[model samples]
Structures are given as C-alpha cells and as structure tokens.
Target: MPVITVKLAKGRTVEQKQQFVEVVTNEAVKKLNVKEEWVTVIFDEYERENWASSGELHSLKFGEGFGMKGIEK
Candidate 1:
C-alpha cells in the first residue's frame, strides 16, 4: 500500500482536485507497483493565512514572488 498526502491552499475546484488525485495515484501505482485499490491520496487544504513562503504570510505576500507566476500558467 502507498499513502500520499498533499497540502495546498484551499479554493480549488472539485475538477482540479480530481485531476490531481488521478494523476498522482496513477504515478504511484506505476512507480511503486502498487495496486490501484491499495494506493491512497489525501489532500489537505489550508487557508492562505495558515500557509507562508519566504518568511511572509502567504495571503499577504504571495503575489510578490514566484507564487502567483507559477499559478498563472
């Protein structure tokens, strides 16, 4: 069995998370040789205020760095 946990800021749509889970689970199944039924993926969504980068609160300072740029594409 393989267990994977991913943490990200909340607000993604259901479709986005579904795609994420599908891609990750498939990769795990292929790389780890785990059965699809034995692979588990958990997404933990946090508020922007609860997450940070570059020592600044993510909600307040995320746009100034590569954060917003990465998401734009």
Candidate 2:
C-alpha cells in the first residue's frame, strides 16, 4: 500500500479536496503502478495564521490583500 500525505493551508471546499484526491490517486495509480484502492490521500488543513512562509504569516501577508479573501472563512 502506498500512503500519500499532503499538507496544505486550510480553506478549501470539499469539492476541491475531492478533486485533489482523485487527481493524485489517479497519478499514483498510473505512475507508481499502485492500486486505486490502495492509494491513500490525506489532507491536513491549517489556519492561515498557523501556516507561514519567509518568516511571515500567510493570513497577514495575503489574507488582507492579494485576493485571498474567503480563504479564512
């Protein structure tokens, strides 16, 4: 069994996550020759404040400006 773990900043709809899982699973199945059922896609959502880059918080950097609205909601 192949286990895939994905860590992304929180704030995506269920549909989006589902799409990601499907695409990732498909790719794993095709490229890694893993069974679709055996492919595991795990998503770990985190608050914008909890995820940071370049020593700056995501919410503070992009939430206020940068068209990142609705990402925290």
Candidate 3:
C-alpha cells in the first residue's frame, strides 16, 4: 500500500479535502503503480499559529481565520 501524508494549515472544507484526495489517489495509482484501493492518504492539519515561515507564524502573518467563512477579519 502507498501511504501519503499531507500537512497544511487548517481551513479547508470537506469538499476541498475530497477533491484533493481524489487527485492524489489517482496520481499515486497511476505513477506509483498502485491500485486505487491500496493507495492511502492522510491529512495532518495544523493551526496557523503552529505553522510558521520566515520566522513568523502564519496566524500572526496572515491574520486569524484566513479563508474560513463567518470568521472575523
């Protein structure tokens, strides 16, 4: 089985995750020569505060609740 792990800042909808999984699964099946059923994908979501780049936390750099609906800017 092919296990793939993707880590990203949390703020994605189920639909987005579904779409991403579908694409990754298909690619793994095709390029890795694995069966669709044997392909496994795991999402490791993180808070923006936990994710940092360029010595700055994403939460502090991009503001809280980026891309999430109903969140105050």
Candidate 4:
C-alpha cells in the first residue's frame, strides 16, 4: 500500500478535500502503479499558529482566520 500524508493549515470545505483526494489517488495509481484502493491519502490539518515560516507564525504573519477558506501564500 502507498501512504500519502499532506500537511496544511486547517479550514477547507469537505468538497475541496474530496476533490483533492480523488485527484491525488488517481495520480498515485498512474504514477506509482498502485491500485486506487492501495493508495492512502491522509490530511494533516494544523492551526495557523501551529505553522510558521521565516521565524513568524502564520497566524501572526497573516493574522487570525487565515487559511480559513482556501490555500493562501
């Protein structure tokens, strides 16, 4: 089985996650030669405060409620 773990800031709709998983699973099947059922996709969500870059927390840099919708730079 192929296990894929994706870590990101939290707050996304279920539909978005589903679509992402579907696409990732399909790609894994094609690229890794793995069966769809054998490909595992795991989403690891974190709070903005829990993620940081360049010595600043995402929550501090982007302010609160950041990444509460979609991907943010």
Candidates in order, TM-scores: namely: 0.79, 0.78, 0.83, 0.86
Q: Pick the candidate with the highest TM-score.
A: 4
lDDT of 3 at 40: 86
Candidates 1 and 2 compared by lDDT, better number:
2
Segments of candidate 4 deviating more than 4 angstroms: 68-73
Better of 3 and 4 by lDDT: 4
Error of 3 at 62 (Å): 1.0
Candidate 3: lDDT of 3? 88
- Candidate 2 per-residue C-alpha lDDT over 19-46 given as tens digits, one digit per residue, 9 for 90 to 100: 9889989999999998899998787777
Q: Output the better candidate (2/4) by lDDT.
A: 4
Alpha-carbon deviation at 35 in model 1, angstroms: 0.5
Model 4 over residues 6-65: C-alpha lDDT tens digits? 898777779989999999999999988989989888999888889889998887778756
Q: Who wins the lDDT comparison?
A: 4
Q: After superposition, how far is residue 29 of candidate 4 from its true place, in Å?
A: 0.5
Q: What is the C-alpha lDDT profile of model 1 across 1-73, one tens digit per residue?
A: 6889888777778998899889988988898888999988888888777877789776676543323533453
The per-model lDDT (C-alpha) reads 0.76, 0.78, 0.82, 0.83
RMSD of 4: 2.8
RMSD of each: 3.8, 4.0, 3.5, 2.8
Residue clash pairs of candidate 2: none
Off by over 4 Å in 3: 66-73
